[model samples]
Target: MTSFPQIDAVYETHLPVRDLDRAVEFYHDTLGLELAYRQEARGMAFFWIGGQQTGMLGLWQAGSAPMRMVLHMAFRLGQEAVLAVPAELKAKGAEPLGFEGEPVREPVVIGWMPALTVYCKDPDGHSIEFLCPLPDAPDPDFGIGPWSRWLQR
Candidate 1:
């Protein structure tokens, strides 16, 4: 028998931002994500985005302008939680930076995951998604399964 591999590592995500305090307030208040820790180092502020041990978000505050929108990070909202995402975004005064259909364009009922899914950008233009369980699908797959399966080529 083989032993299942466990991820014994801390996840760190670095995001460049224009304002650290505003970002902190938005992440904590609007998204309901709690702050774990913060650093006032020379040009950055590392914030833990969830509970004390969930993960950390690194904010690089060395620039006057907000970072570009070339890339983004996402989070899973489970099946039931996906349903409330749009309303939550609206309440937060956010407009979708992506399209209005398909994988990242719009929220749709995906046959692959059997859930209602929607993708959007955060205050710093990071892409995030929310998904609700499928109407008749069994179980759930949180991630894309494998890197190769996600490649377009």
Candidate 2:
């Protein structure tokens, strides 16, 4: 039997939105994702995740109900950039939240993943994260900490 081809990284993700315009503003203006293209007739828009020719995120206008299952998506960033995302979001009137939706003052270190991450929500209530691998994280186990405290230690 022939073996299946190896799978690579995710190329794109399709998310349902109630209003294409609003979604576009939130994703492009607020989140800083580049607008790749749009299909107004189909009520759909696409954004370049990291670069113009890199990964893409598609937004389809077809939902009225609130998101039933919370979807989590993370964007990779440098350590300084990850730590700076929360302040930038707040300055743009976006709420930076913790894992449980609590207001966050800093990014949290995910002990298991050994990564620093900060969370927020998009206009459609989808969970968004900015993450970076912790360079000096403990080898065996390092407890999670807020960015402020984590930086001090």
RMSD of each: 7.7, 2.4
> Can you write out model 2's per-residue Cα lDDT over 3-96, one digit (the tens) per residue?
9999766678888877789989999898999999999999999999887656899999876865454467888889989888889999998988
| Candidate 1, 18-88: lDDT as tens digits | 67777777677777775666776665656564555777777666465444544566565565566566667
Error of 2 at 114 (Å): 0.6
Model 2 misplacement above 4 A: 1-8, 66-69, 138-143
Q: What's the CA error at residue 10 for candidate 1, in Å?
A: 7.9
TM-score of each: 0.62, 0.86
**How does each model score on lDDT?**
0.57, 0.82
Best candidate, TM-score? 2
In lDDT terms, which candidate is top?
A: 2
Off by over 4 Å in 1: 1-10, 41-43, 64-69, 96-106, 131-153
